[model samples]
Target: MVFYCQRHCYETKYTTKVVSCKPAKIDVVVDGKKKKTACYEVTFEDTILFPEGGGQPDDRGTAGGVEVVRVVRRGGEAVHYLAGGLEEGATVTQEVDWTRRHDHMQQHSAQHLVTAVADNLYGFATTSWYLGEAVCHIELHTGQVTEEEMAKIEDTANQKIRESTPVTIAEYQASDPRLIEIRTRGLPEDVVGAVRVVSIEGVDANMCCGTHVDSMADLQAVKLLHTEKGKAGKTLLFFVAGSRLLSYLGECVSRERGLNTLLHSCPADHTRLVEKNQKELKGAQKSLREALKDLAVCEAKTFLGVEPRPPAFFHHRHDGDNDYLSAIINEINDESVLKVLTAGEDKGPGILVVHGPPALVAQIGPRVCEILEGRGGGKTRFSGKVTRLGKRKEAEKYVLGALNGSVKET
Candidate 1:
């Protein structure tokens, strides 16, 4: 006998099961016309794998040294597909990856816990359960569960875990319909086969087919990721359990530390610091604009007594003194003489150099743009922003002196 249902995975379908697993291996040829490996038909003794039943995913792992590639249900028997087929008389020790099995156990039993908790607390049954990647989910049978209520349920479930309630597995055979309450959605109706039930003491009691641990503590914790409304008043609760809970908490702490370091304060300061930076940035922009205005005044003064050469150009290069440079160009906004200004911290700020009309500023503008990573266009007339002014103070003094040409260099 083999416990099998028609499915590609562990998803249980609501139909009469014909036969169950029997501990015997049989050899079968596969890919008759196509190039396929031989397969062994065998009864899996362990209950770790959830054969595709009731929308549950099929169990995955290896069997007989070959990967248990697929657990297919063909004619009410789970056809365990192996990478390499075994002979009819071959003896192999089969083992399932405990990590995967343990996780599946958590999800399946947690599904029961959730269903039980909902029914006890809110008179709701669980219609379906899905243990997906990164999260496990269950759809509540009926009624609405608010987000807060879900949180409360999650807390209760974790409380149960902390309580370390024992999980008991029992097999029963009864003709009474009340016994059917313990059967998960997809057990055979006609046959009086023994039904398996997993009970978590007072916390939960329900019929289940998947493997389970002996205690709720084995789950470690059930962390609710979120929940949302499902079809027909059903609500889906997405969650993580066991080691996944630890990993999720670790990530959360790491993120908190990262954010704290970035903000240079406690995690609470992140939001505050963002607001502070925004206000400071606006003030800094206003100050920069005002500084630009002062520099423009200085430039206008510098252009006061300039030599009236026909094609004289003024180029100002300074270290972080763009205000004066731009001011000079703006004052001499004449198309006859091109102007260029460049300044920045990368250029050491405040270093000023200027030449004009003798084709100096015009020829040097492009080279300065390349050197200082600046950009501007002009035809021997005034055009350029402070591309790089590394020496702001010295350049400002020299340009101011040269602009008036009155203050002799001391």
Candidate 2:
């Protein structure tokens, strides 16, 4: 069946009788929770709203003055999911969201042009394609697409657009002999009626049921963004067409302006300046790690110098990491002295490490972790991530009290 929207691609409004209307539920996310939403699954004798198919999303518009949230193809019918109910057999006006419809038409037609040019220049067949929210991509059967080849394909596609090549469509029965010469991925198992073939003048012709622009001129432009590796040894060519291309360029300019302010350099020198800054950061990190190691040794020496070494020693540093805390225990190298060490932000998140006699360490590790809102367990050494660094003082006092009590009993 040739849908009304497919037949009159430019039509924005149509009056039709409602063929069916039934209660339905659709899944929706509310405040990060998924739940069911009540709606009506409606069908009209004919509609100007295109249903979701052929890699193109469903059109957003209104039916009987009620917002249509979604539309999908069920066999030969376009089912519209309306937020409000419409009475069956009632006459109503259906409006198409032209902005969204036009965008889809531009992109869908551009894909045909791009696919044809790539295949003609190089035998790269389009395995699949995706019309994403922000960009569109065509997955080619080839293993890789070189930068030079991408430029050539993009140039050829836009050249056709510049010429304002006419895009025409033809419909034929499923068993027509002319179908032999046309390119097709395949038709749906449930496909009914005629097969629609969209052709770009002298460039190429292929079977497609999706809506498209009347001519290549409607595309305005095509920009090949980049390429990425796809599964099964394919290459995905990403691009934006028409208004999307303009929007993408605007975003790039905005980002460049922000980078200029942040780096105090122009776009031409951004790469060099960023690389130099990254190298400097690595050097600073190396210096900080070495200083932390030295600080660990000094802390161990200070604890050992005490004539009456405390049974339990607690140490905290707002810098460093778990490795730095472990270094202090390694430097101390004494099982008799219990060591409780933490490193990170004073009032934020940190790591905790405890090392001592086997029995004492096992008994005290879990309790200390609980106090600091963390979790860890070990026989003679315990380590874990801590979240409540603000409770450090209370944890230290509890550990010291436990060790002093154990000492008195011994």
Candidate 3:
């Protein structure tokens, strides 16, 4: 059966009688968390909200003043999932989200145009297509699409839009011989009744069920953003049309303006300036690493100069990374003294490393990790992540006690 949505694509509101209302639960994400929400699966005698099918998402709208979260076709019926239940046989006003509907119409119509143009120009048949939230793409049965070809396809698509080609839809029976002429991936296994064919005036015709604009002019323009390699030697052509294209252009302009302000350069010079800054950053990082290594050596020497060397040594640095801790451990190179080194913020997450006699390192490593709320294991050298760097003093005390106890046993 042809749905009310398919018949009247431009209608935003309609009054229909409720056929059925059944309690149902659906998963919905609220504030970043997914949870089951109670709703009613209500079927109307007729609906302006399109059910999801043919690679197009369902229309969002309101039924009986309640939000319709989702809609799907079950057999020959359009089921509207409403946030609230409506009385059976009651007449209710359904309002479609016009902005969303128009966006989908523009995109869906643009896909038909792009697919036709590609096939006609380069003999690339559409294998599949995706209608994403921000952008849409069609997978062409080809290995690649060159830059020159892409430009030609995009130019031709916009030219068609300028000409305002008419888009027409017609229905035919399953036994009709005309079905062989229409382009189609295949009809659904459960498809019943007539086949819907959407045709572009003198351009192309295909079997489709998605709502679309009446004319190519409604698309305003089409932009072939880029191409990516797909499975089985297919090429994915990404594009945006109408409002989505305008939104993408707006984002590009905003980013360009921000870059100009930060780099104090024009759009043409921004790339060069960014590259120079990255090179300088790499140099600065190299110098810092060398300086940190030298400082580690000096710290090790200072500890070695002590008249009476301590049994246990603890060191903490607020800024260095795990590499810096490893540098300090390598310079000391003492197997007798228990060395505990940490690097990061005082009370935040950090790295922990312990080096000493094999027996002591194994025994104290895990204990120290527990004290600092970290995890690591080793025989003579242990390294792991720690979350409680502020407990460094307590961990040091535990290590010292273990050493003193060992000495007493000896």
Q: Which of 1 and 3 is the better model by TM-score?
A: 3
* TM-score against truth, every candidate: 0.54, 0.93, 0.95
lDDT score of residue 211 within candidate 1: 68
Rank order (by lDDT, best first): 2, 3, 1
Q: Is candidate 1 or candidate 3 better by lDDT?
A: 3
The TM-score of predicted model 1 comes to 0.54
lDDT (Cα, tens digit) per residue for candidate 3, span 194-294: 78899999889999988999999999999999999999999999999999999999999999999999999999999899999999999999999988888
Best by TM-score: 3
lDDT, residue 62, model 1: 57
The 10-residue segment of model 2 with minimum total lDDT is: 319-328
The reply for model 2, stretches above 4 Å from the true place, is 29-34, 404-410
Query: Model 1, residue 276: displacement in angstroms?
Result: 7.7
